[model samples]
Target chain A: MDSIRLNQLIEENYQKIFLLALKMLKNYEDAEDATQDIFLKVYENIKSFRKEAKFTTWIYRIALNHIYYMNNKRNKEISRFPEAHEMRTEMNANPSSVLHEKELFVSLENVINLLSPRQKEVFVMRYYNQLPFKKIAQILGKSLGTVKSNYFFAMQKIKNDLQNQNLLEFQE
Target chain B: MKCIDKNILLDYLNDVLSSRKKKHIASHLSECGHCRRELEKWKKILDITQEFVDQDVKLNPVPPHAHITQRFSKLPQNDESSFWVRYWVKPAIATASLIFIALMVFFFAPKTVPELTENYYVIDNVTYTETISLEDRYLDNLETLYLQEIYENEELTYDILYGDWQNYEEVLNDLDHDELEELINKMYDNEIT
Candidate 1:
């Protein structure tokens, strides 16, 4: 693909892809860098994508591979989930809203970090990126049943984790 | 009504279930308090997940497209490295690994241990053939003369002595000039003249 068409594709998918990267990598700056890198990769190999799958599927495959590689490369450097993004949020707002946001953020981090790598990918792609399981299956090269099961197990695990932490309480 | 599984309830929450299936699950949830509670749990999980996405999306806003395209223009094409990655890297690694493994196997494989007595022979002072080495100085005059005579004539009946001819150089040295000349004349009658 020419640079113009590649530019358009990047513009269209950069945010969603960045969000997926952020959810996976848990750092905004890292996510942005990863997104840019992924787009560069997409640009480099766009001609070879061969329309057998959706462009998004091919792009997402490149993205997840790069993100996973970065995760492993930076594993030693980042011990805890990245709280730098959370820290940068405005704390001048209402204390209660701030606390609620902070609590939800912690719970989210717990669920994400505690999940198995496969479930985490499924969880982020399913809910965070709001991708359909079919597309996720194509991107991951998994059977649709495998993708659904991964999503189900991820959601189930998140539900259980939240209950254990009392982050989710039912009304009487 | 029997309680539906929480996973199906999750699918229902995501609007992934078919209308017929949604209705069946809804009917069950209405009658079953436990299933309703399970639905609440999934709903809470969904909310938390959405919050996670929303918060993250808010944090890492995407870059401007023009800037990304500009960056793309700045990046080196590096087409060769990409081609190598796409085509050759795995095969190269596989071939290298196979060679390494083969070498390791070749160097470490067990074989018949060498026998200690293979090179050890007993010295027989009593029953032994004479091992007389026809030794001589490398360039003794007589030896050189003999070799020269043989080299000059391909057909020589008396050449290349193999017996224990000890001190043949001394024998030649003992001869006087006349005797030496006569010996050379006899050794190569036509060639010397």
Candidate 2:
């Protein structure tokens, strides 16, 4: 791909990819760095991208792989620094007594962050990115059943968390 | 006809189900209070999640930055000959050396097929292979965490280049111990530097 075409692709995808990285990494600076790195990886490997696959799907695959890698590294780094990790954990442990909109949002973010990696990925892609389950399956290289199962599990977790926090009313 | 599965309820809420299936689900939901209640619960969850995502996106708008494109422009263009040299020639040389070493071992050493009884067990008169070797298990663990290593170490760019992102698991699994160790060492070395 020529520089112009690469630039075009970057311009088109910058926000979507950034939002994905932000939601996945849950840190602004890390998301910014990841967005840049993801594009650079796209640029570097543009030559190998086959024509049959959609560009969006291909780019999403790259972004997701990079995000997962970064998230894993971040988790390992946190494990190495127990004090700081404990402090962050303590902060999250104290849920607000009042379920204000802002508090609800915070609780939602926490609930999302708590999801298992597979569930989180599927949920984020489905909810935030608005990617269809088929596309998510293609990107994750899993079956549609697997992707939907992950999303269902994630929804179950989020619902349980919200109800536990009294952010949403419990239903029988 | 039956109570809606949670997965199908979610698909219905997300508007991703086929029109026929969706209409069928809608009809079922109307007739069944239980399914309706289940759908309402999922709907609430979806609404809250969507609202939170909308607010988050609005709060964290992407700042204007032109440097990303500039960096892309600065990247060196693909060179065909260099690609072949880096990916093909080097691997060919390594394979040839391994073959040479194996040939020397074959010619110089007394070779006997070692009995593999310890690695197999009889189950219902069927020989079952034992668990994978320790080294294979180690490599399996490494492959599981290979994505982390790729991001932690920049030196694995070659691995990225050689493997398509879609098949990263397979590609990482194919990496031998020597390569994985070298990559891990490079990651730590870079961190120290």
Best by TM-score: 2
Provide the lDDT at B16 for model 1: 82
What is the C-alpha lDDT profile of model 2 across B1-193, one tens digit per residue? 6687888888888887889999899789779999888888888888888888777767777856587667767755555367789899989999999999999998999877665755433323145433433355665665665567677877686667765665957777899999888877988989534
* Candidate 1 lDDT: 0.71
TM-score (C-alpha, index-matched) for candidate 2: 0.59
TM-score of chain A of each: 0.75, 0.79
Tens digit of lDDT per residue, candidate 2, span A20-107? 8887787677788898888889867877775634888899989998998998898998989979977775664422212335878888
Fraction of true contacts retained by every candidate, in order, equals 0.37, 0.51
RMSD of every candidate to native, in Å, equals 19.1, 30.8
Q: Score the docking of each candidate (DockQ).
A: 0.22, 0.22
At residue A1, give the lDDT of candidate 1: 40
What DockQ class does candidate 2 belong to? incorrect
Model 2's C-alpha root-mean-square deviation from the true structure amounts to: 30.8
